[model samples]
Target: FGLTRDIYETDYYRRGGRSFLPIRWMAPESLRDGRFDTLSDVWSFGVLLWEIATLAEQPYQGYGNEEVVHYVRYGNITLERPPNCPEILHKLMRACWTFSPGDRISFRSIVDELVPYENEDFRLNAYYHTQPHSQQETVLTDSNSDEKDLLLVDDNASEQQ
Candidate 1:
């Protein structure tokens, strides 16, 4: 996740000139720098909007990662959502890919905007954990200290869950 220009220059991009970034899933700030926030990730997800609509065809096809880097640096390759894409989605994608990081929309806003499509069961599936409490406790306590403490506590707990 901590992608940097130095790494990009030395690694994948040098081999094929295009790194197959799957930019749809990558945070844009990753294309620029590592100090990005969630908004940058949302921007990547917005790009995913187009990819999903097109069944994962490359974003900005005909360019590799290096070419994309150059084009992005020069402000040349503005992404256009596929012609058949919906206007609401197109606008959403635009907000996600804005050059200025501050201008990108928040994930909360995106979810709010998409709320109309959600069903009652959809809300419940996410809001409530289905596993019984006893099962959860059993799983949490079953791991040995070595396995449980392999990494930092904060992240490990989440991983175990």
Candidate 2:
């Protein structure tokens, strides 16, 4: 979401100083023109997922806000998959971070992709620790695997080309 400053009793304007804003979470369009909507939130969610995969490491480490904006807008420096992150989850994060707002995956699609792993015993920590390397490799290699299918949905059905 773009920063807002209260302008009237119940009205707000999307303009503010950038001192506290974390530019790493901002979408390129938002950075360029202060335009934002749900797609911007999707981009931030991708960064949050990256943070989770990296055990909460700071994103765009050592980069200032202006530098991050320039890199993202012009250089297209998206967050890379953290070490040991599951391929399926990293794919979902990439979907969320598509450069075009209309091309980003929907929140509904994200939940659908995650639903298969929602059982009580399906803790991410436990799964990461207990799953054998061979099994992980098999899942990654199988094109028809559930995880791959989960990442392959057509989420742009409503957007015109």
Candidate 3:
């Protein structure tokens, strides 16, 4: 695969030492109990989507690390959907952020949901139909809006093999 993540581990906390954690991208449960499980990865992926949607803007822009933990873990706050993000991706991100781990969408299901969007038809539906191959980029433009979006993908996807 062009860029794949391999995940295989259980949640843990060392008994008598300090540990580094990704504070902003953590799930509520992870922040609460130091439990970083697969479901936590889903939550982090949602934040990653938010980062991409914001063109790398930091999540909870006005909040400090402790504030993020308090708001997300106790206040049940989540980042609002970016104004320019496509509905489909935003829906996926929301699913990934479900508070209950059991309710969070699985990675396999995320792949299944996104698989259909790989086709030209879905791009058209999303108003991202242009397919200029030179830079390996697909551009999304809306006639009524000034914003433009770019998506880069490999011509030879590993899934094709």
Per-residue lDDT tens digits of candidate 2, residues 9-93? 1211133643445567888888887788888899999999999999987777766556677887764688878999999999999
Against the hidden reference, what TM-scores do the models get? 0.60, 0.61, 0.62
* Candidates in descending TM-score order: 3, 2, 1
Model 1 TM-score relative to the real fold:
0.60
On lDDT, the candidate that comes out on top is: 3
Model 2 has an lDDT value of 0.74
Error of 2 at 20 (Å): 2.8
lDDT per residue as tens, model 1, 7-119: 43322343347544444344546666645578778877887888887776667777676777766655567676687888888888887777777777889989788788778
Clash counts for the predictions, in order? 1, 0, 0
Name the regions of candidate 1 deviating beyond 4 angstroms. 1-28, 119-161
TM-score of 3: 0.62
Candidate 2 global TM-score: 0.61
Give me the runs in candidate 3 sitting further than 4 Å from their true place.
1-17, 120-161
103 in model 1: Cα distance from truth in Å? Answer: 1.3
For candidate 3, give the lDDT: 0.77
Q: What global local distance difference test value does model 1 have?
A: 0.65
